[model samples]
Target: MSAAAEDEREEQYAFPMPPAGGWTADDLDRIPGLPPHTELIDGGLFFMSPQTDFHMATLRLLEFALVSAAPEDLYVVREMTTKLAKRDRPEPDLMVVPRKARTSREQTWYDPSDIILAVEIISDDSVERDREIKPRKYAGARIPHFWRVEKSNGLPVVYVYELDPATHTYAITGIHHDRLKLAVPFPLDIDLTEI
Candidate 1:
C-alpha cells in the first residue's frame, strides 16, 4: 500500500480519547467505531485482538460442553460482560449465568451475582489480563468460579478456582490436564483434550 493510503486508513480508525476520569462501563455502549468485544476495566477501554485458531476451537468446545451439561436453570453465553462496578466491566470468554438474569434480548451485560462461572482462554497478547487482572476483579466481585485455560504443548491445561467468600478471594481448586471434573456451580465433566 502507498504511504498516503496507509496514513489515510490510520486516520480513519484513530483510537477514541478517554474522558477526564477515564471511561465508565456505560461509555462502552455509547462509544461508536470501537472494536467488537471491547471491555471496560478500571475506567479504561480494552480492545480485543484477532482470535487465533486455538482460541476459537477451544471456546467452541467449551461452549458446547457446558451448554450440553448445564441444568435447565442455567444459560451459557460467550463474550458477554459482567458489570462488577461502575467502572469495571470485563467480558469473559464464556460464562455460566442463571437463566433468570436475562431481563431482555437487548441486555448487554450481567450482574456479577448472576454469573456462576467465568472462563478465560489465554492468548499471547492477553496473558496479563487473563491470568492476573481479570481474575482479581472477578474474585473481588464475588463471582463463584473462575477458570483459566492455558496452552501447553499445543493442548489445553485448565486451572480452576473457587471463590472464598470470607476473604473475597479465589482459591485454586484444581488443575485439570486431560479432563475437567467439577462439582460446584453444577456438576460438569469436560475433556480438555478435545480442545
Candidate 2:
C-alpha cells in the first residue's frame, strides 16, 4: 500500500475506558479508538489538551523560536510520554528531548535518563495538578529540569527548576514571566514580544 497508509497503522492506539482504575502500558497499546496521539500520566488517561487558537499560535511561534535558538541538534515535542519507572508515566505539555528520539522505536519506555527539560503548560482546569503533583513526580524522577507555565491572565508565569547541587534533586531556580520573557530552554536573545 502507500507510505501514508502504512504510517497510519503505527500511530493508532485507540482503546475505550473501563469503568475505573489504571491501565498498564499493554492496555494503552490495545486502545482501538484513540485520537491521533496521547500520553498516559499519573495512572490516569488524558487526551492532549485541546489547543485553543491563542495557545496553538503561541506554541507554534515558541517552537520555531526555541529550535532556531538552541543547538541544531536539539528537539522539541508536545505530549510526549516519559516513563517514570513502574509507578508512573507522564506526558507533559512540552518536552525537549534528545534529537531524533523515537517513541515507537524504543526498547523501553522513555525514562528520566533521556530527558533534559520537562515542561507543563497549565490550562485553566489544571493549575493545582501541575504545580503540586506533577512537579513532585518530575523531581522524584530526578529529571534535571522542570518548567511550569501559566498562560491565562494577560501574562503567563513560567518557572524553571534545575537539579540542585546540594540535594542532588530538582529545585526551583528561576521564574520568567512568559509574557515579559519567553524565559529559557531557549536561545538567550529571542524575545517573547517578537512572537
Which numbered prediction scores highest in lDDT against the true structure?
Answer: 1
lDDT per residue for candidate 2 within 1-195, as digits (tens), equals 899887787556435655356665445556667664455565666666566655565566556655666666667766556777553666676677777565575433455776777878776656677788778878777777787766645444567788775676667776765433434555444344443
> What do the candidate models score in CA lDDT, each in turn?
0.91, 0.64
For TM-score, the strongest prediction is 1
Q: Please give the lDDT score for candidate 2.
A: 0.64
Worst 10 residues of 1 by lDDT: 186-195
Candidate 1, TM-score vs. the true structure? Answer: 0.95
Residue 158 accuracy (lDDT) in model 1: 90
Q: Give residue 188's lDDT in candidate 1 (0 to 100).
A: 82
TM-score of 2: 0.72
lDDT for predicted candidate 1 compared with the true structure: 0.91
